[model samples]
Target: METAQRQQQATPGAFTAFARFVLCGGGVGLASSFAVAALASWIPWALANAVITVASTLLATELHARFTFGAGGRATWRQHAQSAGSAAIAYAVTCMAMFVLQQLVAAPGAVLEQVVYLSASALTGVARFAVLRLVVFARTRSQATAHAPRPVPATVARAPRPVPAPVARATAPATPAALCPAA
Candidate 1:
């Protein structure tokens, strides 16, 4: 049964997992966009992007780490790093998508164009979030086992003097071989 369960997990459920993760990233992205716009109102786009990226990164990393994956056993500094890296990749992907959208929209430096492009990029990168969650964010099978609470050490489990076996003690006197010598 354990072997079967392990084998079952080896197969990836890409679509379902991606759908869930994408939704999670989408929600985060919406929030981040608002934050960027508010900040960008005062700052230049590039600078605003950097600040917003870093700040939003701080916010998104934790939430995405928790929300994107069902099995969240390993929420550590390393996991946060991985989340940030994946998010940066998603950020880059969104940037590229926005650039393409901007050209297609033909609205040069229009605030509406900026908003539209950013929104669309974020919308498309939903797939990226799912991909990251399944491939990069999900906990390893080994990690799951490793995190399980371990049994106490042998020294703790055992007293210095062990209790005698009651069954063996009861049977010993009744056995003929125990009391009589062999001829």
Candidate 2:
């Protein structure tokens, strides 16, 4: 009982949540990477990347809300907004890295560009997980414990009450004689 209560009071552990985030994020990343690469093949790099980034961010936010964080009920506009913000940060990192790499390598091929983007995205995953866990899905201690129910005892043992000692009665000779006469 004590251990269970302490566990409830403690903040949620990161290992399980991180694992879920990785699984969900990996799927989203795979889909988005393909989209980015395909879109870049046809459209201008900047426009294709931006459009795909927004779409993928929305999709990933919903996925993470449902599975990664276990906050399906709490998913709201605010969460979407945070997801967008985090995605923007990640996108900026990716774009900047791509630009620098292209300048340094001189007309890098499509495969190389894709690799750079994926690498940047991988680095950004750490930040994204942190933001989602600490900011977006943050729960107060009270809020965390609010939904939990207290355990009811199956049986209760009550202490026995002590018995009082008996007292001797005082003699009453006159009263006894009168009572005897009446009888």
Candidate 3:
């Protein structure tokens, strides 16, 4: 019964976390797309994308740790490295999408480019959310157990050994009635 109640409570928390993930991570991704587009005018498009990807990944990891995953504090170096691994995958996905778009249309308009880039980002964002939740920000089993009360096994939880009744004074005879009181 208690386990069911806890699972029910967790369902809403997971949903809330996903919603925040979209808001925070998606917002950073959206801004990065525009930033990439602008920077591409000054540098090669691939170079611009690489620069923006690194910056946005750092920002998004911090936001996800602080808010989306309820990680309770700033992201650790290990978490950042794990996050960067997933972000690298997302970057590859976006780059491939853009490369494909370029191959398909010689002169793709800015709107078409944005649409393709955003679509690719949204897809990778879902995957990144899973990776972040399950890997980068997940609480270790030891950490979880440290905070939670451990349940005793049924055998270990058996009623405490029945305490022996007090013996009568040596001078007085001990009666059965005195030694074992009626329930």
Candidate 4:
């Protein structure tokens, strides 16, 4: 019964993490859309999208690490690589969505472009979460076993810190400067 209880307790909850993830993803999508739109006047939409996609993916990964996964310290480059993989897939999907929207919706406005990117992000969110939770941040079986809480003795005394000794200071003798003759 206690083992079963421990098993139940060890399982990570979803609702809070999912909510944060969605919010972070939405913010990334909005920022990416604005970036793309801002650059569109100076550059082609494809180039703009590529640049913003890379930037947003990095931003989103960091945000998700802190807000969504509660694994800020634990998140590593490998986990980031995993997140990047998801971002790559998401970027491809967003580009396709944009292409389709351009064909179907004439003269897409700022609002329309944002909406399209957000829709794509919403579609990709599930896959991103799955990879982050199951692959990137997942604990090994040994780690899980090791992490199980053990009973500690209530009366254990804490260790005391050692005191430091004062040291004698040594001073260097000053050297006199030679006077220069008038030039």
Best by TM-score: 3
**Worst 10-residue stretch by lDDT in candidate 4?**
173-182
- lDDT per residue (tens digit) for residues 65-156 in model 1: 55545444335677667666766676676567666766777755646645764666566566556555655555553455555456676765
On lDDT, who's better, 2 or 4?
A: 2
lDDT of model number 4: 0.74
Question: For model 4, how does the per-residue alpha-carbon lDDT over 104-138 read when each residue is reduced to its tens digit?
Answer: 98898878888887788788878888787777656
TM-score of 3: 0.75
For each candidate, what is the lDDT?
A: 0.60, 0.79, 0.83, 0.74
**Model 2's TM-score against the true structure:** 0.71
**TM per model?**
0.55, 0.71, 0.75, 0.66
State in Å the error of residue 94, model 1.
3.5
Spell out the clash pairs found in candidate 4.
Answer: none
Backbone clashes in model 2: 0
Number of the candidate with higher lDDT, 1 or 3:
3
What are the clashing pairs of model 2? none
Candidate 4: where are CA atoms >4 Å away?
1-12, 140-145, 149-183
Clashing pairs in 1: none
As a TM-score, model 1 comes out at 0.55
Residue 116 miss distance in model 3 (angstroms):
0.5
Summarize candidate 3's per-residue lDDT along 1-183 as a digit string, tens digits. 554344333332668889999999989989999999999999998899999999999999998877787665688999899999998998899899999999999999999999999999999999988888877877632244355556666775568888999977766547878777889
